[model samples]
Every structure is written in structure tokens, then in C-alpha cells.
Target: MANMSMTKTPIAEQDPKVRARNFKEVTLGYTAEQAVEEAKRCLNCKHRPCMSGCPVSVRIPEFIAQVAEGNFEEAYKIIKDTNALPAVCGRVCPQENQCEGKCVRGIKGEPVGIGRLERFCADYMADKPMNIEKPEPNGHKVAVVGAGPSSLTAAGDLAKLGYDVTVYEAFHTAGGVLMYGIPEFRLPKSIVQHEIDNLTAMGVKIMTNMVIGKVLSIDELIEMGNEAIFIGSGAGLPRFMGIEGEGLVGVYSANEYLTRINLMKAYLEDYDTPIMKSENVAVVGGGNVAMDAARSAMRLGAKKVYVVYRRSMDELPARKEEVHHAQEEGIEFLVLNNPVRIIGDENGRVCAMECVKMELGEPDASGRRRPVEIKGSEFTLEIDTAIMSIGTSPNPLIRSTTPGLSANDHGCLIVDENESTTKEGVYAGGDAVTGAATVILAMGAGKRAAAAIDKYIKSK
Candidate 1:
């Protein structure tokens, strides 16, 4: 029988006070009983509206039904059939805006804890061996650029179709943004590595530190007998406000800051990487990256960390859960405030920032209310370090090196609806084609490109 509870089951989490000082994961995931109860909240709606919102189209109701029955391994299999990274998606994917957002139960009360249940099932089967049979090789060699969500997803799907797949990643590590962009507290590195291991076990070959454009061009991969190439290099180039004092010693881009703490292991005492130790820090933006930067500053022992945004809380683009967590950890939000310039000390280090108050005006092209600057409302924030978390664009290395592959004015690779680039036998997806986006969306693009690539190779 379906559980008729109006509200979803709540899961356990670390205390805000304690978790703020440590780098441990914040959510403790659902216990088995909790998972079952939460899963039961699923009405098993015949229409299955929740599945429509998911990028990779995981069998939402089917998996939840299995979880309700306590058949965890079965549930895991159902999720894994479509999503290659259930564990990573469960923790990081914005369920509130996706699966859980369209849930029927959410009409009157809280939606089913789909993400929580997914996480539970993944953790339940973590130690169990997956008896997967490697498909027979099809003799078609495919090369994927960048070992990010999209590339990994494409590689996994292609391998399942018996294609010989090779993934080349620029970084020494394989997980791309999953390893270097996100902090440990949100998504553990171990979960990412385990997923990568699964792909390798399926006969997917990964070559790290293999810069596609620098080490070898796309034409070279084709010359080396690769029948098809998929680019998922992602958008790593960070955007700045181009304000004064941006070149100051203490000014850092969110990408560089996160890379230092996450990939370079600067947060660990055992690691030799150097990082800035500051008492007061300012993060400029209102997206998830801004929240991450602010919360990370707090964990790094900053006495005060402020999130400066030109928009109000409602206009903030970050996930609500992340914003709430940041508040719980004592990160201050300076909404409706825009930074105009950074002030530097005589030693060329950041000492403060100049900002102006803003008010909401008419909606802009993005449909969000445009921020209008308030006249003579200038103010200053005393911050030793400033981290710019505005946004990012795709790096131009691949486009500049590869001929016949065109990119839009925004630096995103142009692709058709099928994710096929202008260059024959070459496709691009993820952030490379769409600019900065969610991991699940990137995975969806990769999955689609895999199908397209398969058709192209078989037709040839």
C-alpha cells in the first residue's frame, strides 16, 4: 500500500556548529528505515511527471518502488541503468528543481525524498560487488576529451555498446570539475573515484594529463585511428568583474580558489600546497559557486565571510539548501549590494572593497528583475581577501586548435540538436556546448551524443 503521509521523512545531518569547522559531508544520508519510509511516499503516479524533469530520465517511480520494498540492490540497478553516477547525482543534483520539483505529493506537502532515497540505495550497495559483464569489442575506436560528467557518461554508454573507448583528460586527475570545482564537504572525492573505477572496469581506457588541443589535436586523434571524437572539456575559464584592484595579491577567482583547496589539497595540513589564510573574506555572486566559496572560507577559519550580490535572496540562483546551509554556518549575505572596486593596501594586497546599494527594477532578458544602482549609496567592506564567483566560459583552447569546429560568441561550442559539431566525426556536449551547467544536464548531453555517435559510426 502507498504511504499516505503528507510530509516526507527527514534525514539526519551534522550539526551546523560542528560541521562548519570540519570538512566532513553535511548530510548523513537516510538510514535504511528512513529510506523505505521516504520511498513509500511516492504515489507511483501513472503519469510519472517527476521523470520528465530528470535530465537522464532515470526510472523514478520504478526505483522508488524498489526502495519501498527494501529491495535496495534492485533499486540501485534501476538507477544505474540510466544514471552512471547515482551517488554523485544524489548528493549534488538540484532535485528541488528537477525530480522532486514535479512530484505529485509536493502539491499538498513535501515531495518524496527521492534524492535521499537514491543516496541511501547507493550507499547500501557500496561494498557489494557489481557483477557486470564487459561487452564484446565492436572494433570501433572512439576518443572522448575531458573526464568530466559528460565524457564519463558518454564513455560508459559507448562501452556498453561494445565500442572501444578512450577518454583523455587534461588534468592529472580524471573527474574534471567533480574533482577540482566542487569542495569535499558537498561531494566526496571517493564517490567520484568509485564511479570512474566502474567505467574502467567496463573496459573504458582513461588517459589523464592528456591535453586534447595541446598534447594532440582533434585531427591527430582521427589520424591515430579514432573513428569518432566527443568533446566535453567543460568551461574552466573563470569570469571576473574587471573591476579595479582585480590584480591585487589577495584577489582570486572562484575557480582558482576551489582548485587550490579541492584539487591541490591546500586544505589538508599534510599537503604542501599553499593557500591564503585570511580573517575576513568577500565572495561576489549569488550562485552555488558563491555559496561554496563563502562556506569554504568559513571552514578555512575566516572570522567573517560575506556573500555580496546585486540581487535579493529570491533572485539568488543558488539552490535553496545550499543558501540555507551557508546561513547556518554563519556566512553573511549582503544582498542588493554590488561591488564596484577592490581597495588594496600599500603592499599590493587586498584590504577592502567599494560597493553600491542596488534596487530591483524592471525584468531583464533573463526574466529576473534587473538591479538598478542606487545613487550616492556607496559603501565599503573591510575584507582581506576577495574571491570572484560571478561565472565562467568555455576555454578557447579546443576551438582555437580544431578546424571547422565553430563556437558561439559566448565561447560555447556550437552544436546541432543532436550534439553534432560542424566537424564530421566530432561532437561536443556538456559545458563545452552549453557553458556552465549542472552535472546531470551534462550527463544527459553526453548520453545523447553517445547515441548519435553510435549511429554515425554504424552508418559509416
Candidate 2:
């Protein structure tokens, strides 16, 4: 029987005060009992709208039924049938906008804690290793660019099809954004490593520090005997406001800051990575990246961290859970404000920032209310460090080097309906095609492109 409870079981977590000062994970995963209880809440809707909401189309009811039956290992198998990174996706994917959003239980009250249960199943399997069978080699080879979620998903899928899959990552680490972009406190690197290890166990070869464009171009890969290539090189080019003092010594982009702390091991004292010890830091923007920056700044010894968003709280594009966590961790939100310029001292170091108050006006192209500047409402804020978290676009390295690969005006790769690019035998997906997006969406793109690549290769 369904739990029939309006309220959901609360997952344990670190204390806000303690977590704010440390780099440890904030939300401790659900216990086995808690996971079982949460699974019982799934109504097992005949329509399975929750599965439809998922980008990778995970069989929701089937997995939930296994969980409800106390067969977590079976549930993990069901999830793995479609999703490659359940643990990471369970933590970071915007469930509010996706699977959980279409939950039947959520129609009247709280949704079943799907993410929590998924995490439980994954963690359970991790603790007790399960035997997995490797597919026989199909004698075909495919090259995947970038070891991020998208490329990793495609690599896993192709490897399962008995193809020789190799993932090329620019960074020294395997996981691209999963290693450099996302914080360990949000999605632990160990978990990501475990997932990557599973992929490697399946005969998927991962070569780190392999910059496709510079080290080996697309032409070189084909000549090297790779059958097809899938570009999942994500958007890593950080966008910054063209304002005075932006080049100040204490300024940093969210990507650079997170990379240093997450990938470079700057958060630890033993590591030699240099990171700013800002006393008063301000992160500009309101999305999840902005929250990560603000929270990271706090852990990096910032006495005060401020989020300067141009829109109101309701207009915030970040996950509601993230925003709430930020608030609980003592992050001050200065909403309805936009930065105009950063003020610096004579030594070219940031000292303060000038901002203008904004009000909601007409809806913009993004369907969100346009923030209009409130004239004569400019003010100054005292800040030692300024971190820009506005947004990012795809890096032009591969696109610029690869011939016949067309990109849009914004530098995003243009692909056909089959995720095939202008160049034959090549396909692109994820943030490389669409700007910064969710991990699930990127994985979906990879899955689609993998099918297209397989079909394209067979036709040859």
C-alpha cells in the first residue's frame, strides 16, 4: 500500500553552522529505513508521468517497485538500464523541474522522495559491489570528447554495445564538470570516481589531460582508426560583465574558483593550490553556480558572503533546495540588484563594487521579467573579492579546429535531428550544443547521439 502521507521523510544533513565552515557534504544521504519508507510513497501511477519527466527516461515505477520490495540492488539495476550516473544525478539534477515535478503524490502534497531513494540504491550497491558482465567486443571503435556526464553516458552506452569506447578529457582528471565545475560538498568526487571506475571496468578507456583540439585534432582521431566521434565538450568559457575593475587582482570567475577548490585541492592545507582568503566576498548572479561560489567562498574563510542577483527571489533560476541551503548557511541575498562596476585600490586589487537597484518590468526573451535599472539608486558595497557567476558558453577549441563543424552565433554547435553535426561521422551534444544545462539533459543528448553514431557507423 502507498504510504499515503502528505509529508516526506527528512534526510539527515550536517548542521548549517558546522557545514558553513567546512568543505564536507551538507546533505547526508537517507538511511536504508528512510529510503524504504520513501519508496513506499510512490503511488505506482499507471501513466508513469514521472518517467516521462526524466530526460533519460528511467523506468520510475519499475525501480520504485523494487525499492518498495526491499530489493535495492534490483532497483539499481533498473535505474542503470537507462541512467549512467544515478548518484551524481540524484544529487545535482533539478528534480523540482523534472521527475519529481510530475510526481502523482506531488499533485496534492509532497512528492515521493525519488532522488533520495535513488541515491540510497546507488550508495547501497557501492557499499556491496555487484558482479557485472562485460559485453563481448564488437570490434568497432568510437571516440568520445570530454569525460563529463554527457560523454561518459555515451561512452557507457557504446561500451555496453560491445564497441571500443575511449573518452578524452582535457583536464588531468576523468570527470570534466563533475570534477572541476561541481563542488565536492554537493556531489563527492569519490562517488564520481567510483562511477568512472565502473565504466573503466567495462573496458571503457579514459585518457586524462588529453586536449582534443590541441593535443590531437578531430582529423587526427579519424586517421588514428576511430570509427566515429561524439563531442560532449561542455560550455566552460565564463562570461563576465564588461565593467571597470573586472580585471582587478581579487576578481575570479566561478569556474576558475570552483576548479581551484574542487579539482586543485585548494580547500586542503596540504595542497599548494593558491586561493584567495577573502574576508568579504560577493558573488554576482543567482543560479546554482552563483550559490556554489558564494558557499565555497564561505568555506574558503570569507567572513561574509553576498549574492548580488538582478532579479527578485521568485525570479531566481537556481534550484529551490540550493537557495534554501544557502540561506540556512548564512548567505545574505541582495536581490533586485545588478553590479555596475568594481572599485579597486591603487594596487589593482578589488576593494568595493558599485551596484544599481532594479525593478521588474516587461518580460524578456527568456520569459522572465526584465530588470529595469532604478535611476539614481546606485550604491556601493564593500567587498575584498568579487566572483562573477553570470554564465558560460562552449569553449571554441574543438569547434574552431574541426572542419565542417558549424556552430551558432553564440558558439554552440549546430546539430541535426539525429544529434549529427554538419560533418558526417561526427555528432555533438550537451552544453556543446545547448548552452549550460542540467546533467540529465546532457546525458539524454549523449544517449541520443550514441544511437545515431551506431546507426551511422553500421551504414558505412
Best by lDDT: 1
Pairs clashing within candidate 1:
none
Instruction: Give one digit per residue, the lDDT tens place, for model 2 in 135-159.
Output: 8998999999999999999999999
lDDT for each residue of candidate 1 in 347-371, tens digit (9 for 90 to 100): 9999999999999999999999999
- Could you estimate the TM-score for every candidate? 0.99, 0.99
Stretches of candidate 1 above 4 Å error? none
Task: Give Cα-based local distance difference scores for all models.
Answer: 0.94, 0.92
